[model samples]
Target: MSKRARLLAALVVVMTVFVGAPADADRGISVPAFYTPPSSLPSENGALIRSEPLPLALSLPGLDGPLPGRATRIMYKSTDNNGRPVAVTGAYLEPTAAWKGPGKRPLVVLAPGTMGQGDHCSTSLALQRGLILGIGVTQSTVSIGYEVLAAYRLLAKGIAVVQTDYVGLGTTDRLHTYVDRVDEGHAVLDAARAARALTGTTSDVGLYGYSQGGGATSSAAELQASYAPDVPLKATYSGAPPADLLDTTTAIDGTELVGAIGWAVNGFVQSDPSLKPLLDKYLSDAGRAALKDLSTMCVGDAIFAYANKKTSSWTTTGQSIADVLRSEPVARAYIDGQRIGTTKPAGIVRVATGVNDNLVPHPQARTMAANWCGLGGDVVYVPVDNVKTPSPLLNHFGPLLSDQGTAVDWLAARLAGTPATSNCGALPGQ
Candidate 1:
């Protein structure tokens, strides 16, 4: 090879080596360009558009059940799954009649699990019922209908809730990280920072999420102390979060959900460039086609694309997806770079999962509990019992919402100056 060409190839090799370094090894990924305050309104045509005092007669059909106590639309910017600029639009809800006085209420940031792709999926109008709680899911509709009702109950208690439509999923940016924690966590916490920066703000805040939201919430909590110290974080509740990315990758080795795993790989790769070569090499034409086509696709759409389609000896086209993911420097870096538990002494934290959680496994939560306690972090790991089944939603997604009351009570106490407990005992039992 010519000297210049050899030099170029050498540079590429060097870049790959540094990009794939471990979590604390080196911060190799390029930081995103969007440093706009989270409170900035969305650019026109963005996935999450902000319009304060949300129109009562908006387009969403399922949001007419009850009126929120108090509501306002918020515009903010959160990095997309690919670490690009994504304008986030949200609705802040507070119970109007519950706390009639001028006292500031505790704020709750609700990061929801996965939902399908569509305009209707990013509904913020559900906050109309109150408590900053409402439908948070795919870009169109929520994964579960009753979640809106639960938000209403929480709002009635005079809490501020900020729900985020994760970076790319709400609008069309071409990637949703699935369970990739860091980016999702940044978006989730920034929403709170954005909400706090708004004209009317609060001092105390907490976070709540299920499934994908669980992972996002956990990440946000871990990074909360250092990332947003001014805004006190009382507690964080995550249901069935994929806490350990490496373990999650192993658990879903050859399952139908391998397609979702593709999205995760793409997300991590986008955030850190080192994995690009691996993605380019291991991903077959079919795999590449799947990633390109599904970057903007939602949950159901991805499932449809990879269903029963096989390449080589695998049952589905996802085998190549996993192969590329395992070989990539970016994947190795991300798995090693996960920022779980506390980044700097965090406040109270709670994680709950069904013993049978299939998508996000109970073992992951158990491991998280142990790690946090080992770090001297106050953690509460609740094992949800009602959802003791093998169904996808029941096992992985339902536990977070199943014991909503208990989780909320725990948070409420923490915000009320009550110290939280750690589940150090349950860690070994599992």
Candidate 2:
């Protein structure tokens, strides 16, 4: 790692020490039995497997629970892209705040941003333990439950939130399918089903997410028509969605999250065995080691270990990930399969992007909106042009924090039977 990277890591370590939070007791070592998938799953997609009440790690006065709502750790049946029944784990948060909307209530699957590949890094786990400070012999896996901020906002509005841990993040059976279009979309749609099973609430649904979550929700919106036709998907709030992974890969290179390239590689290869040639032919031994390390790391450990590193060092030929994609037609085609916006998203959709976000990039997200507009879909384009951060990761995050309120509000209105207008009609390049 570079000197600057080491310094960043050290500074964070020092911050954790000063904060004085106790180290995670057993989570640092083994995967709990609760995370284990059933020996045989039910054939129906979105079938409820089991659930148990989960305690939120964060607490405050006047709140009935540690959170603004009640949380449950749930495992549900969901199919992967390859047509196999997979046990997907997630959390269902029922708000204490009463629903003042026009209908019974609405449930929104809050697809989380990139939470990393470890069971310890799951959003469901994070919700229970607000901040996990994992102190391993080699390194610590750290992830603050930042998704709670958005979940709290929705809960305050009396909307129920079901957060998916994706296909494998918490579940020990498989590696987290980082952003496989089919895997992510199916996990999210099934989370809605899991929520309904837990509460038996016949409520309309909305999808909300940012960054990786954005990609998942957007994918779910498009897939809902066929995949989960029973789901009453009312609207989707997609923030900084990586509609095109090729562009996203190029954009993420050399940033703090450059290690994410490895996450994607590990996921793609695991999901499609045909891509295993990539491991032997292209990746160097050091690259393989990095993938092993990242396989179980959370975002904090990832940034600490691989900050600002480039992918050139990972390849035998010293070629960047961009180069590998350019050189290998099969690899490029496989990644292209992860791209969103191929079909117009069903129902009202709000697509927001940071104009200066080079991390996920701004153009691909805009392209999704344009594609929806061309298809005569109800699309509202919200460009968060107000802020720019010098740091690439922060630049991508800026829009999410700034636009989350409006995004939630838009979803709330749609859930309350408001007719969503299409700004695509007046927008340029539509």
Candidate 3:
């Protein structure tokens, strides 16, 4: 077996041992009814559609314990890439501890990374359940617990947290629009607006996310000024963001996390129906089957199932999907639309990436920061120290663990209204 395959096999064993045999099979599982929007959605975006108080136990599922906060699940009005109205679901948690900050209590919008394409993969559901395991054989519940733990950290600091599941991930029956710049940004910004309307707590906002969430947070930062001008965005912390899709998709191919490519393809086709025929002409039977299966899987399951599986195997001409992307005009257009750094964020933005990150590619991340800086945006570029590991996955994941504390502190400082120092001039190769 190849190195990536061996790593995947080991991961399966570890997950099985730690998570245990998919318990109860139905304990915290429920099909969301509100995922489907009404035929005539309200023209106004960011309007609160509905809300209910989340039980305390489900609010905090960290290993240490539940957080001191009140959780509420909210369905809010948002917009699709075409400016059509849509309904997005998210969780709002108000810490019991009083706000010690200057001006009203601050709200931190937490955009979760790639969880899965299924509805059961909802972050709000995971937050409410406290510990998210397995809903069925189709779902992998590995990272839900960690996600809640991360949110708990913000809650502990007396900063209210609002987690957006992104469009279609948890609430919609349609395929989740993974990595679509506008859709993800709209979901995040709308979540902030919905939280402000529903809670009436604060106007100050901070955006935090890594990996896929990082991309969303970065997109949200750029869109905040034009999309939701009323929302006061304080700071944005984006870690390992896939700011440039053309580079990111090429880097992810043939890696353990290659399944993300499939998610991106599905999202692109779903957003623009015209792209469907273009993809169909290139995709092979194997590719179709793989995408079909991947659509139902969470990140954990996808990593294992498609590890080291090249996109070339999915094409009729035996050409890699990356090659097709470059050669095909329709594919190129769709991908180009997803690129970030075209607009500067309204507030100070901090970007972090592992020096040896293999999943999203370190150089592209540097380019993103540089592009933002060149646009006269205030940016703090942090290249995490490299990890000594033979496994490529570890090279990508180690930074997320090592840099968590620093990211938390940086965001906390932003929430505290501390002036951020721009290191654009100091960025490598600048």
Instruction: Give, for candidate 2, the lowest lDDT window spanning 10 residues.
Output: 12-21
What is the C-alpha local distance difference test score of each model? Answer: 0.58, 0.84, 0.79
Model 1 C-alpha lDDT per residue in residues 313-383, reported as the tens digit of each score: 33144454444445556665667677465353367778788887766667877777778888887777777
Give the root-mean-square deviation of each candidate in angstroms: 15.3, 6.3, 6.5
Our model 1 lands, by Cα RMSD against the true structure, at: 15.3
Worst 10 residues of 3 by lDDT: 11-20
- lDDT per residue for candidate 3 within 1-430, as digits (tens), equals 7332343243323321123233432223444565555666566787888888766433323334344577888888899898777788888988765567687778889999778776666787666553445534544444343466457667767788898888887765477899899999999999998998897655689999988989999999999988999888989999999988988888888888899999888888888999889777999999999888777667776777898889999999999888888898888887888898889887998999998897788888888899999999999999999775766667877877788778977888888888889999998654
Q: Who wins the TM-score comparison?
A: 2
Task: Kindly list the per-residue Cα lDDT of model 2 for residues 1-430, writing each as its tens digit.
Answer: 7332342243333322112223442226455689989899988888889999987664333335433668889999999999989999999988876789886989999999998987778888887766677665645667877787788778878899999999999998888989889999999999998898889877999999999999999999999999999999999999999899889998898899987888888899999999898778988988888888898887877898998998888889999888898779888899887889888788989999988999999999999889888977789998888567678999998888788878888999999888878899666843
Regions more than 4 Å wrong, model 2: 1-29, 61-67
Candidate 2 clashing pairs, residues 3+ apart or interchain: none
User: What TM-score, over all chains together, does every model reach?
Assistant: 0.73, 0.92, 0.89
Ranking by TM-score: 2, 3, 1
Q: Which residue pairs does candidate 3 place in steric collision? A: 35-171, 58-128, 61-130
Candidate 2's displacement at residue 398, Å, is 0.9
Model 2, clash count? 0
